[model samples]
Target chain A: MGKHIRTVNANQAILRSTLQGRGCGECQASCQSACKTSCTVGNQVCLKEKKQ
Target chain B: MIHKFIFDDTRMVFDVHSGALHIVDELIWDLLEAYGALPEEELAQSLSGKYLEEDISEALEEIKELTDKNILFSPDPLGGAYKPPGESVVKALCLHLAHDCNLSCRYCFAGQGKFGGAPGLMTAEVGRKALEFLVNSSGERHHLEVDFFGGEPLLNFDVLRMLVDYGRSLGREKGKEIKFTVTTNAILLDGRIGDFLNKNDISVILSIDGRQGVHDAMRPFRDRKGSYDVVVKNIKSFLESRDYRDYYVRGTYTALNTDFSCDVEHLASLGFDNISLEPVVAGEKDHYSLRDSMFSQISSEYEKLTRSILKMTKEGRHINFFHFNIDFEGGPCLPKRMSGCGAGHQYLAVDPPGTLYPCHQFVGREEFVLGDVFTGVRRGDLTRLFRNSHLYRKEGCGQCWAKFHCSGGCHANAVIHNGSIEKPYSPGCLLAKKRLECAMYLAQWKNAPDKS
Candidate 1:
């Protein structure tokens, strides 16, 4: 919403959805790309838009 | 928002916005969230279902008492705009004296000591201007702190001596007390260096990463040799200088040493009293980085170290850990914070050739450069960007319970790991919360009644 921004859907951001049922359901996905960052048990993965 | 940590009989509630603390029962805690939303009559009716009418009234009164203090129902939930301590005095200045180091620390934030740029030393002319900037900008401040920092500040000891002399003379003229501190690895510290430090009234902070094996593995010579023996030997010599009681022996811990309680214990055995251990900051994929898997290991070690410190204290030993000595009760009253350290406003970092950044972590980062020493601070787009980069403006931090304590967290690290200064690194937040809890427990332990 600031300027020159892109929003991604759940399907776009999440890659190799976990078998543990921790899908990116209600979670907001700001990036629409193959996940270079892993979806760990701890919230260390960068699921949101990459910051400056 | 209140982040409550459960102890034994009571829970410690920390108000993230104001840093206010409240210890309350389960009933009062539950009503804190539900009571604020409804009208008094409706709230009383709703709460009557769970308790007697008299109990409901008492609960409402309690909520009103806290609400009056602006703790529970804060008008500015995001902790109003960042306040710059009234005046624009240059109270503290960190001078990047040497942008090169003899040791290649794996977690060196300044890019292997050269700052990801050409290796160079701060010239005498530049150092003189830095002093002038500090004295001129320090308005009405009697005490100003000047820190000599870098890959190794001891690299250019000549310029350091000259600057100290000039700064002292200027201090007397301005009726100010200029305190000088240098952060070094102690590899270059010799008899001459030690004598110069004491003679010029310059205090030194020696960096030695815990035990021999862990330190040598993490911090190695440029040629990849162990530097533990040399550093320890020089540290002993450096302490022999005049008035040496006022220095901190700082160390950093990484994945290489998950059993870092041993490091703290090792430092105590080495006869260093004032000791502080820091968690190493490294990239996520960097194998030596502290990962989710290492949390339990680190946590257990931290607990062990805390117990050991209490044992040592009981034995009449003066050894101390920096993490446990913090006073959560003494932090700033809510409403005047954006970032972790007072970066843009109160503090500023200066690299060679006179470029100004908010702090030392972002020294080599050009995009974050505020301005140079000559042109003064450029209050335009960059300034706005830096000022706006607080907890209130940060995305995830707005709802955080540790918001004020961390203040949107470290800007450089957020950008480096998450890709934006607008984002708060969750790992850093977890670390801060865990450490704060430990600090609190230690404080409570110190004030505990004698069960004996």
Candidate 2:
């Protein structure tokens, strides 16, 4: 069970890294707010990260 | 991986990265979303309201942003931040290759191809210089296009070849592509020339009004003989070749050829991919005695021909009316001020004697000369000609619905027809409005339920 959870966590980290590389690729977040209405998943992730 | 998100048109894919939509450039996006498939007339009507001013102002700001991004391009080949009064981006260069022609068409704008007053053939040296000028002036990033025009470009073959070679060399050096096109009478086009042209990937626009009789009446050789047979034979020869078969051969027609049914079919049979029908510019005499009845008859014939062509294109017949049709998510038609006409900004045509004019049509007008190409491109004069802010119609055209679409019509034509560019020229404007209305009506009809 612990090994399975570790694997899941590793997958999540990989996904998060990919998303981070792409979303913050420009490094300038000028278009982040403008895209909120269009991208619910990204917005939720951003909000969750903010809370964390 | 580029996550693609398409809005409005599925053909245009908007790249989405993470949650943020990767906007190619703010101008193109704004132009796409702002207009939102609204036909010109409907768009105009929407803009007629007072409350729309703020929205338009905001859209214009986005357009400026897009202009800065370099994604939304002007038709002008000369790259600059210069915006003319009430004009959109410069879209095309009206280059004239030879002011002299073998044929003396009655209504020839260069005065029956007479050599006395007008400038002669553009030299190979001038052509190379011009190509170099275009490459340098277009900046390091953008592609360049050259349209070889004249009383007849074939008359000056050496210069044309040199220009093409120079353009290719410049393009290779700069890591840019160059597009070359020529407009000619086709009387001079032979089998050898046709084969050479086919191999070179050059676009040829032939002038053959409708039929032999109609064409002969308008265009005749210096010896007063009809050269229709020779032209038709040459076109057939070119079309028969496998290489030239796919080449874009556009047929230019004048309004005098009123028999739509016969002309359209005849031209189509000749293997022309596109047909550009222009209304005859009434000379000094005809202008005063312009008849509404004559115009209506011509308009009706044009409408019928356009309908047939549209139907053909819809049925996948490959015939395109490029002068009227726009590509998917394309920039505004002639009217949009966002990227105005090429004129003094993007392109300047040099006559034989080395006087640089805004365009070929304005070549003889001494006042329009930007400078001599031999002395190098005059930045000051070119700038003054380009940023003629006084030329823009802030009062009348700024508030117009078609402001983003038509860009207030041709400046040279306006000055020639009317006394100034401040007021819109009647003929081109009226014709554009009529055409736009027809396009909108057709779009609606196509979407409507069948009547069967």
How high is the TM-score of chain A in each model?
0.19, 0.20
Worst 10 residues of 2 chain B by lDDT: B11-20
Candidate 2 residue lDDT tens string, B9-38? 221211111111122233333345545367
With candidate 1 superimposed using the best TM-score fit, by how many Å does residue B58's alpha carbon deviate from the native? 11
Against the true structure, what is each candidate's TM-score? 0.75, 0.65
Candidate 2 ranges beyond 4 A from true positions: A1-52, B1-95, B114-119, B242-255, B258-262, B286-293, B310-318, B332-337, B379-395, B399-401, B444-452
> Chain B alone, TM-score of each model?
0.83, 0.71
lDDT of each: 0.65, 0.50
Clashes of 1: 5
What is the lDDT for A39 in model 2? 10
True contacts kept of each: 0.00, 0.00
Q: Count the backbone clashes (under 3 Å) in each candidate.
A: 5, 23
Best by TM-score: 1
- Which 10-residue window of candidate 1 chain B scores lowest in summed lDDT? B331-340
What's the lDDT for candidate 1?
A: 0.65
lDDT string, candidate 1, B177-224, tens digits: 887888889998999888878877776678888899999987899999
Query: What's model 2's lDDT at B339?
Result: 26
| Model 1 alpha-carbon drift over 4 Å, by segment | A1-52, B7-11, B15-89, B199-201, B240-244, B329-339
